[model samples]
Target chain A: MRKAFALIVVLVAIGSAVPVILHWWPMAPDISADGHLIDQQMASTMVEVGSAFLLAQFLLAYFVYRSADRGTHENIRSIPGGVKLAVFVAVAFVGAELLALGMQGQRAWAIQYFSTPDPNAMTIQAQAGQFAYYFRYPGLDGKLGATHPEKINEGDQNFFGLDLEKDVAARDDVVSAELAIPVNRQIRLLLHTKDVGHSFYVPELRVQQDFVPGLDLMVHFTATKVGKYEIVCTQLCGMGHHSMRAYLRVMPQAEFDDWLKQKASEQ
Target chain B: MRFKIACAATMALLVFPSGVWAGTITGKVKVDGPTPKRKVIDMSKEPACAKEYSPTDPPRMESTITGPNNALVDVVVYISAGANDEGVMPSQVVTIDQKGCRYIRHITAIHTNQKIKITNSDPAIHNVHPLAEANREWNQSQTPGAAPLDAKFAEAEFIPVKCNIHPWMHGYIAVLKTNHYSVTDGSGGFSLKDLPPGKYTVTAWHETLGTQTQQVIIGGANETKTISFTFKGKAY
Candidate 1:
């Protein structure tokens, strides 16, 4: 029974660790041009963390097996370093892992967040509400008209509430339910929330950004693939949070231009 | 003299059908007690709706609209029982419009299986989400100038419809089995005319205020009966 117990512990540890180490269930394909760095960071962290986890599990199983023979309290003795040494080792080991992981992650985070968007990059506005997302593109003038929150009438199909009659710039703005962008073209997306805090997450694009109410935040990315991906809200804003989703379509430049034109016609 | 009497009787039958149009019920719904001040809607978020009203006369919340004489607007008064028209479907398509981000008619009473046509007259996009417990709920999105959306409720229910995109916008769609229903106008007046002579369980429903029922009886003669309901006022 003692031998069986030890075997079970070891088996459980290996059985749980192997599948994750090999990444048998991988993530969706990365479609963003800069997502490679993020993927590298993620892979490195998983490997490093997985090795530590395996080490701890193996040590636990080995101790359990060793103690099985010497069951009495008479054989239980303090280690050479005592409890103090164990605490120090734990702190040092965990602290080093965190510092290393954070440093590695900074490379991936900085490249996407720290750099300035190119002047010619397309600018799109993304607005998050209780249960839906709407995207607006700057039309031919390459400029977005000023937005008035008071003018937002969803019944009128005016989500942004731009005064199109008075604002010529707003008349050409194209709003779409889906976020469509040209592949390989840098897109500067301005994020705003109409109500509560919400997050925009797309696994394939390796992008997850939150919209802080009353504040406008920007995210820039260039998609490498041309396909449709799901853009879901990770924030639990309200009862309809689960249904708060939109589509992210990375299209060819010509197709994207035509889509924008069609949306503009709708406006 | 006999021929003249026959002509007069025939004209009376033509003007008012014998069993169908026996009597009419007319009434007003009044709210009792101290009225709560309505919250002025901050149209700063909606310039189009706001531009129409001034700072001193801003748009107010439509949850409980009150008028002079303690009048309650937007209440749905219908015959719940003792009416012969139960399960009779209405063929007329009731039209509702979304203008200035508000439902043009706050309360709509339609018979079960009656078509309700919803149109977007605003410049922005609007979505219709009906939270119905007795019937299958549905959601639809409409753009400006898009075609009207028509829907039907298969069962009787008081479904609350809202624009998820605009949280403040809300209205009610009352689907009843009987065609004898009337929604109170601005003056809190409602008249269910051409009701056949019968005892009716008249129910008055308010969105914020609970429902009240009063028994009304109509004689076989072409007479008009009066009734009224008053809901206890409370601050929301």
Candidate 2:
């Protein structure tokens, strides 16, 4: 019975680790300039945690299998070092592992959160509502107009509630349903929510941020590839949340200029 | 035999007339008691629509557009029972426009087989999501400069339509089986012309106020029955 139980435990451990080793469901390819750091951090954590899991399971199985059926006359055996020593070892190893992981993550974390965007980073405004995303671009003056929540009429398609009639800066602003940026150029995306909380997540870009209601947040990233990607809301806002998504289009610098010009004309 | 045949022929002509039904039901809907102050909509964040107002003249809520003398502007009156309408759904299309972030006709009724068109006249995108129980629920996004969307409901129901992107955009589309319906105008006076002389359960529906029903029996030729629905005022 002991041998059978040990064998089952071993089988379960191996069965779980096989998928990760074989990469059955791997992540989408990273297309952003800063994705390498995040990928490295993720891989290191997985390796450190995975090895711990496999070792713990194997140790448990080995102990079960090695346990003996002794007569009443035999003395119970204690572990080699005692509870205090065991506790010390656990604390030392686990503490070291945690410290190492945290220290390793600083590199990625600093780049994502601590550092400010570049001076030449193009600025864009993104608004997330119940079930959709609307993006705005600063036009000729390189300035985004102030927003009026009441004037955000969907019927007039005047989303973002820009006062075009009076606000000269807003008259030329370009709004689109998709996020388009020049490849390799830093993008400063200012995130705002119309109503409830929402999150902006893009798997390929390895970028995720949340939009708190009544608060504006910003994230910056540079896409290395000229391709189309999907931006989805990870936060559950309401009934239509599941369908909340927008597209990200990365194009050449000249093409982006032309695109922005066309979009501005459409405004 | 000759007299009996002549009487039967005259009765048949009255029952199945080649001309339109001459009976009419006309009346006014009044709201009783004190009226509620219109709730001012806060559009401070929406600068486009907010610029039109100031601290003393902010935009007011428009859920129920009431006229002078307590007349309900958007009430829909129709035949609810006891009338057999065998005519086909009208070939004319029913159009609803999205303008200034509001539905052009707040309350619209169309026949079961009739077509309803939704157009976006504003510069923003409007997501049309209809909350329907008896019929299939559908949502579609209409973008500026895009073609208008057209659809029809097979079953009879009163569906509340809203713009998901713009929470303030809301209206109702009453999918009805009868073609003899009248949506009350600004004066709260509605006239249902050509209602055949017979029995009918007349129903008046208000978006804010509840619905009311009255039974009318038209016994005379080309009868003109007058009826009125009085609803209590809502403060909120």
Name the top lDDT candidate: 1
Question: What C-alpha lDDT values do all the predictions have?
Answer: 0.81, 0.80
Please provide, for model 2 over B1-236, each residue's C-alpha lDDT reduced to its tens digit, 9 standing for 90 to 100.
Answer: 53553454356456775346677888988888655444444332223434645657544445567788888877889888744563457889999998766677878888886898899877666788888899999999887768999989888888888888655567889887787788888888998777655667889988767899998765554789999999887643
lDDT of 1 by residue, B1-236 (tens): 54553454445556765455647889999999765445444333334544666666655567678888889988999989866666677678999898877777877889999999999987767788998999998888887899999999999989889886555567889999888889888789998877665567899999878899998766555779999999998742
- In candidate 2, position A145 carries an lDDT of 91
| Model 2 Cα lDDT, one tens digit per residue, A138-193 | 98899999998988855345669987667888877887777889999999999999
Each prediction's DockQ? 0.07, 0.10
Candidate 1: deviation at residue A253, Å?
A: 0.7
DockQ (0 to 1) for model 1: 0.07
The stretch of ten residues in a row with the least summed lDDT in candidate 1 chain B is B39-48
CA deviation > 4 Å runs, candidate 2: A68-84, B1-160, B165-236
